[model samples]
Target: MSVLDQDLKTPIRLRSLTWLRAPWLFWGGLLILTWAVSHYAFDIYRALDARWIIRFPATWQPDFESRITAFMDWLLHDAQLFGILFRDVTRAISAVIEAPYDLVVDVLVTGLQQGIGQQAVQILPPLSWVAVIFTVTAVGHYTKSWSMAVLMGLCFTYLAVFGQWESAMLTLASVLIAVPIAAGGGLLLGVLAFRVRWVDRAMRPILDLMQTVPVFAYLVPILFMFGFGPVSALVATIIYAMPPMIRVTIVALRGVPEELAELGRMVGCTRRQQMWKVLVPSAKPMLMVGVNQVIMLTLNMVIIASMIGAGGLGYDVLTALRRLDIGGGVEAGLAIVVLAIALDRLSQAYAGRTVTQKAAQSQGGFAMRHRWSLSIIAVILVTGLIGAAASWLQTYPDALVINTGQIWENAIGYINVNYFDTLDAAKTFLLTWFLLPVRQFFVGIPWPWGLMAMTLIGLRVGGWKLSLLVFVLTGLIVLSGLWDKAMMTVYLCGASVVIASAIGIPLGLLAASNPVSNRIVGAFIDTLQTLPSFVYLIPVVMLFRVGDFSAMIAIVAYALAPAVRYAAHGIRSIDPQIIEAGIVSGCTRGQLMRRIKLPMILPELLLGLNQTIMLALSMLVITALVGTRDLGQEVYIALTRANTGQGIVAGLSVAFIAIIADRLLEAAAKRMRKQMGMA
Candidate 1:
């Protein structure tokens, strides 16, 4: 037999064959060839043949400027009239009712501003950095460990030293307030959905849409309703952050052991009592995971909310990006990362401890002496007292106050003068030679033909239902008068996903093969996933300018995490027995991978594809800032002009697209899993 075949037949000696040709080599080579052809060969040919592509009549650019100006004019006029009428109505009503509650609200507002606000402002000077660090470390240690404690201490110290203490605290305060509200709301909704099948059915689509819809899409309607400020930011954050919690809670609750449910029933428990005493406790781990996810997502939204005047680290990051202040951006980004890690670890530890306690309790008490409940309680009480005392003394001051707006304005001014002029020259070259030509090819395809091709592919992969779903989804986009825009979005997102998969798959393979590489890549994935999506945009825009290419590049960077993670997982999950079988059959390394591994991992690879698509779409609204004409642009305009109806409609359209894609992909994944006997 050949050396490759002989090596594959030897089980124990396979470790030495790390350098042997694997199936990936062939696939990877094919991909490289295809990329070269697509990126260079086709590009060159397309450039040469560009004049031959049929050009459709250009649609009039919507009279956005005039329309927006007129809308604003009318809105201000209406607001003036409404303000006068509201004042007159309130006066008439107040004169008639003269209620004590109205007086109470007025007094409370005045008191809050005068007493609490003044005290907070005055006391801001005495709180020492050492004390703050100590407090954070103590809390972290109490919740988790010495490692976490040290990390937390360092994080706080960095925040204080870097002069972002006040803004950080404000952001923290908002999170502290918003997290509970979101968690409680999510828990309630989740419980309701679990109890009622119809509620679950009703909520499923809404939750899916909420999770997938671009962040900017919600800003328009929310801003219109609430107006722009921290309150509006809070509302948007809550909406965006709550959905994952609700889904997680529902999933966890449903996963409660049936035996436990029966035991609860046998104990003469009412349904409510059983739920509170048994179901919720049983689902604590999952619920906590949900809480952890909620906090992370909420924190993620904080910076984005700053764009609408939420005023926190998000604003700092936004300002930094606008001004190309890499140092400031990195600092703010690091703060966010530290916060995310601390919270994630603490929550995970809490969940694990709870599970351990439950297991220990099942085995009876004395053995569970490791329980540190009292210590935890003591720490909480001590921390609470310290916080209360500090509040009372009004001695805690803000750490840093850096106005980045001027920095941004000056930077933007410079860009307008020099950078854009350079960018415009590049833009002309790219648009004329590259983007326009490719876009024409995509858009020029007959819609019916495109629909048919996609539907058939869906049918082959996922069966008839998915096929119909894909068809309807594409059909709806066409009907919405956004067919071209949707196609462009699809092309950009698709290209990014493909490129991400190309890079990620190999990295995943490499990581899977090496323990050190695996750990490093995994950690990197965590960091990348936690970094706010906008951070990627700044660098991407800097490199590529504000256009489709930059947006696509950003999407690729952001979407790569899941592809790498899932692909690594899939490779690692390959059964040892299967590898043994390949060995016994004297399959070469390449043959083993081709005949066994790739086929076995197809389901998982598709799952990665699904995630890649989802993540790419999530950037829809964010990409608008880079100047791609898509649904995100519509959403942005709606927010800017305070048009709730338009925002909601546009948001729903994006949601529909996500849902359609999700359903189709999920169905395909399910089918593949079943076919592979992995379901």
Candidate 2:
């Protein structure tokens, strides 16, 4: 056998001699010595009050932000392609997008109009709430089951009764237009990437950066380029949400069986025919997963997109939150969650709809095959005629609409007044004992020392190429003069991730071991994952007030799902034959688990850790609104000021941190997999 083949067959634990050649011991000693020296220097700097030793000197930092801003200015105004100004190009693109966007909006919310202002007449009314609810319910029943239809029906009914129908419909209109464009664009790019090897290689890093960069980071540029309105918001939502579908499409297409590809070729099919007719159809099951992800992510962007004038339920929530109208904010937030759940369920059901089921349902006749579609059409016409007579059918009656805002306010007030001391005491205890100290330690470390430590870890995990990548990316943060803020981000994200992992791993273990726990935990995490990151902040901000403590709480809640999910998946994915082998070897349950399962699943746990870190970083950005001073805050401030340069820098700093953490953890997992002979 070749050397690589033989090495792959032999597990690292059985190769004792290999350790003799490794420099890990020397590196470990040097790492400890470097850490001690850095701490000694920190003490000296503290005594002498030399702040520059701990923090990079601002005067020496590069002026990247100004240069970036200048370039953007040129691109927006001065720069031109051929004979056309860039602004004109952008405007032309906007016109194209706006055509369909206006169509959806008019059909759903505004109603079709003719002539100008005073002379304008409504050609048609927007879809009535009754018609909308019926269509959604029928779609659910056709796609999945009676339970799904009922769920969708009740959700829309609640929206109408709660007086949020108009806002909800506006949001739905944006989603309806954005999803097809984003999904189609992503599908095309994914197909291109799959067919061309170099394209796949090129897109990998871009996709990583796109996903890791917080949504807020790119908003300023999009707003600047597209101009602030629903168009800009739609554009931002598309950009933010499109990456996942691309990733999912690439993965799904790559996973298609080679035999299937060969079968197409053997039948004398052209490459295009093979791809579109055979490969895509075979990958449809997985592609549907991508569609579901796209839908959920589009909804998640609603509130964030609203910041740029994409008005809807998101605007309502934002206005309420800014005024500290906690009750109103919670109501709107719940509306978002309800909308998310309804859309998520419908998309998932449609995706899960199989050929057999579809065919079986369609077998009766033309009318029978499309009974739901006909019913939906019938409802719309009936509702439109009735709405003309009794306007309440067109618009829910104001007096009959429910208002739970006062009740929610009263409950929050009761808790605040009665449990003020207890909550404050708990918050103080955590900040004083654990959080503050960790923050101070991270902040006190000299920048070079921190950089060196990370570089060394990268070297150990993945070698010199990884080490250099980590150094350069992190070093740019220092060069950009955002080192302190980056450290603060690291501190907050790291602490939250640690806490989440501690809680999640044990729960995941419990769920994996017990059937009832599995069902309960599985369902809970599924719901939690579907809710937008903003919804988590409302409840947290209410209870904790606003500070690092509150940010940490929100981050933990938003990030906890991934840790739990990955851990359970890892535990459940173990080979049954391995368990049988352990039993046959006369090992007890605990022995079998510790020696075999835990070691075997270590890579998966590492992956879970990686996901936890990524989520914590993303949530940290949203937490900036609550007054945490970190990289997220920098991005947020830049966004508010429309400073593209500053936002991009800070955003990149956050992305770099995430990329470093992700790569290091992935490297560790790879090493573990190699050692376990599973690579």
Candidate 3:
């Protein structure tokens, strides 16, 4: 195995000894070499570009763009038989889903999405904003969360001050409607999947597909069928948000011990009774986690929903971005973040409340005991009296409104004067010294060899089925002629994930090791996590200018929060007894972490990596706006043009990359679990 060995006498030995130790490195180099030869030495681009990537003429496989568009057109226009059946089915679904749409609009505003729902169903027109504010205050008091109440008030006040009350109300109403539906549907489906073996088998892949596909993909068909409005956005939001709920549900329910379910049966409980009284309650904590996730995801879609004319803060941000008004977009984006933070805190606090809270309500003071009832009655009378006294009391006065766009612009000017030069130099160094080389390595890979190398990776990680998937998807990208862009995305996302993991894992370890540190860092991570992806763009654009490097930084910034969060959770969740064992064995803190903590926490860390991948890909799409020439750019362009075919293909490529990473990680985790006797 040394230099003395004949097999070790070559460059292969050097690669085997160093770079190839990481699979990513090994395949990357081989693919780059293949492409270098193909492009520079042989000039294959002529033939490839001639067929316009239609049929790899070299192989005979069809291009994805042309074929997918043809398929979509056939399904929609040519397949009258199938089209009629689908049309009828969607018509029924559209009719059924509209009920909730009407209800949501009615509860939020009077004339919204007018004519969609019955006039008799509209309810909130009679209620003043003051009434709604007071109700939120009452709930806040009940939850013992003055901070949450203040956040909510600030959020609403900001919306009012900005004269965005109507838009803000629409956004909240959509979320209010979407969360329950997403959470409820997810819970039901999750329960059924958990209870039925076949259902679980069927659901796993479908959920994977649903979650991995970009949220924008949902708009294409739904917008076509339902036209535009709240219902379309609501449906897309539900679909986009539900996967996490379903996943958490399955994981939580299964986490409940078999002995507990057996105890329910031992008490002579029937199947339904046992499921209701024992299983569901046992899984409440995880179900609540799912609910928290559902809320965040639904909010995440606020801007994407705006793309289809679903108005609100997202629309405001989109409008600002469209006008190239960075200050205005940042303002709107801030409002969305505040809205997200308020919603996230409210949902978390309510979800985390214990039986003791209810017990206190029964046994404690009048404020606790009466909670919402007395507060509601009083607030109603006070608001009614105020409305009677002056009409201006119903909503914040226009005369008192503040314009913060100028403030944001002034702040940008200050930053540019003070820090822009330093930031530009650093960005230049990062691009010239680091990212360009890595990006070139990835983007230079020849299609055929890249496909084979990825297939090999699939074979090593999973099996033939995975290899086939890798082969097919990679081939699709090459054929679609979006190969360079897709690889650029791969390079950026991969680099960002690696950097994020490096930073996050150590930070997580620090937090995990100390209770106080955990709380402090957890708060910071929570704040970062709640900021909308849109908000991540503004500062980086200010610092680095519009480019791939800036996009990478933004992707990492948005992605890093989840990495640290899950890593800390994984490390902290390690069994205390195992740590005690390590201590009894005379291990130091460092040794205990290496020998005991890491091994036990590896599975959770892999799950974190999976999450990190998804977050990075999601951000990449947003970064495309900042001038990253990746699949996100294609998707972004597709958005502007409403190019369904190009968007779908590009989105699927991003999805396939994420799914492949997920599958590999999952495969590795399964192997680790088996080795550790966890499976």
- Candidate with top lDDT is 2
Candidate 1 per-residue C-alpha lDDT over 1-679 given as tens digits, one digit per residue, 9 for 90 to 100: 8999986788875555343234465446544543444345345547777422222223522433345445544553454464574335434533432333223222212112234543643222333345546766776665667887888787776666566665676677667767887899999999999999999999987888889878877776556545567766777888999998899999999899999999999999998999999999999989999999888888889888887768767888888878777557766766777767767777777777754544644574653443445444454455445745565322234444333534644665667577776767776775677666666555555444456656655565565677787788776655555555666766667667877899888778768878999999988888888888887876566556677888877887888988898888988999999999899999998898788987888778888888888888887678888898877777778777766655665666677677776777777678778878889
Per-residue alpha-carbon lDDT of model 3 for 545-626, expressed as tens digits?
Answer: 7888888888888888867987889886777898898899999988998888888889878988888999998888888778
Range of the 10 consecutive residues with the lowest summed lDDT in candidate 2 = 13-22
- As a whole number from 0 to 100, the lDDT of residue 327 in candidate 3 is 81
lDDT accuracy of residue 64 in candidate 2: 95
Superposed on all Cα atoms, the candidates' RMSDs to the truth, in angstroms, are: 11.4, 4.0, 5.8
| Cα lDDT of model 2 by residue, 1-679, tens digit | 9999998889876564354236677567765666575558767687989877777888989899999999999999999789899999889988988999889888888889998888989999999988999999998888898999999999999999998888999899889988998899999999999999999999999989999999899798998899899999999888888888999899999999999999999999999999999999999989988888888889889999999989998998888878888788888888888988898888888888888888889799899988888899999999988898999998889999999898888998899899989999999998999899778767666787878877777777787799999999989988998888998999899889989999988788778998999999988888788777887777778888889999999898888987898888888999989899999999998998789877888899899999999889988998999999999999999999999999999999999999999999999899889988889
Candidate 3 structure, TM-score to reference: 0.84
Ranked candidates (TM-score, high to low): 2, 3, 1
lDDT of 2: 0.88
Models 1 onward score TM values of 0.74, 0.93, 0.84
Off by over 4 Å in 3: 1-55, 58-85, 110-126, 144-164, 266-268, 360-371, 381-385, 463-469, 479-481, 573-605, 673-679
**Model 3 weakest lDDT span, ten residues long:** 50-59
